[model samples]
Target: MVDLKVKLGSLELQNPVMTASGTYGYGEEYEDFVDINRLGGIVVKGTTLHPRQGNDYPRMAETPMGMLNAVGLQNVGVDRFISEIYPRIKKYRTNILVNVSGSTVEEYVETAAKINALDHIPGIELNISCPNVKEGGMAFGTSCPSTIAVTAAVREVYNKHMMVKLSPNVTNIAEIALGVESAGADSVSLINTLLGMAIDVEQRRPVLSTITGGLSGAAVKPVALRMVWQVAQAVKIPVVGMGGISNAEDAIAFMLAGASAVQIGTANFIDPKVTEKVIAGIEDYLVRHNMTSVAELKGALQA
Candidate 1:
């Protein structure tokens, strides 16, 4: 029998197929279309110490093969998430990882501390890589110094597994990955949407409110795969690959590239059942390849 289980830091996922934050609400929203328990992990929407209204409308636009979005970081503050959302998802059989973000280091640490208090939540995905926001998001993720400081600060209070999400908008992504890994980050997930923009020629205006948004979908798969490969080779910790992953072949490709696991983002919007399908496809691929476990595929690239 093939084993699909994968480990991220101290958390053991049933499989590598997890729903990315923001794409999948608290896991309850897709209950009708997806079997939440079947997923390896569920990363809840990005949360801050306080609530955020997010950016203005016209936050999303369609590009050639991908989509651009500037959703800001709209989320019910951590308090509300714990009191309201937590109770609902705490019972899921899979690991429930909270995607934490903030405007400042203190806020990030404080938020991480709060999430640490939740006994049911096994881990937190630190999102210093959100491009839609003006303040904290990508700013912290792009700078190696800020990456080290914020992660180390949160490490003090957050006892559970902590995964740092790296932004694609950077000069040296691999360097940033190494910095976070050294700063007590248990793991790192990468290629958080690339910065992009769309324009309306006739209207003579930008498509999104922020004028620029994070590009995601099939268009980003190659870039995501390359970045994942680079960071995975550079860091000792596991790397969670994401960006434009839409099917099982894409997930497998990431695994082969060196990602210990992967997060399904925009694909969830297209097909809520995509996670289950990817899981099944992985199994089929394993069988066809005569592999016994998914772990064997990590960094298995022949070239």
Candidate 2:
């Protein structure tokens, strides 16, 4: 039998497939469509320190092979999530993580501290990479010093595993990864979303409410792979590679490129059962190759 289990920081998974934050609602939303416990991990939707209305309508637009979204960071905030959402998802068999986002450093620290209070929540994926918000969204992620400041601050308060999400819009992704590592981040999730804009020729205006939104889908796989490879080589901490992962092949590619694991985003909307399929597919790949463990594939890429 093949051992598909993989280690992500302090968390262990039956497999390496995880549902991306924002794309996968608080784990319970897909109970009818998926077996929530089967997933290696579930990252709940992005939650801020306080409630946010997010951006206006027409926040998502489809481009060739991908889509752009500016959904802002609309959520019921941390308090509601702790009181309501946490109690419900805490029972899941697998790791249940909160994807925390904030407009400022203080908010991030506060939100993370609250999540840390929850016994069942094992970790948090910081949303310093979110490009949809107008205020303190991607700013904290792009700059090295700012990344260190925010991550270090949260590291001081949150005791559990902290995964800092990295923005792909920056010039040097490895530099950002190293910066977060220095600040006490347990692991880093990279290639959140590429900033892109769609145009409506007939209307002669931008397609999204925010004009430019985070681009995701098959189009970002190459870039995501490159960044993941660069980061895995640069930093000692494990890297969670994401962006345009549609199937087991994509997930395996990421593992081979040195990603400890991967997250499914846009593909979830196209098919709610995709996560299960990817998990099964990875197992099949291991069996076919006569590999006993999934960890063997990680960073196994040849020069």
Question: Tens-digit lDDT track for model 1 on 1-303?
Answer: 899999886899999999898899899999999889999999998999999999999899999888999998899899999898888788899899999988888889999999999999999999987432445345888888888888999999999999999998898899999999889999998878888999999999999999999999999999999999999889999999998899999999999999999999999888889999999999999999999999999999999
Task: Name the runs in model 2 displaced over 4 angstroms.
Answer: 130-138
| Pairs with backbone N, CA or C atoms under 3 Å apart (clashes), candidate 2 | none
lDDT of 2 by residue, 103-131 (tens): 77888899999889899988999888743
Top candidate (lDDT):
1
Q: Ten residues in a row with the worst lDDT in model 2?
A: 129-138
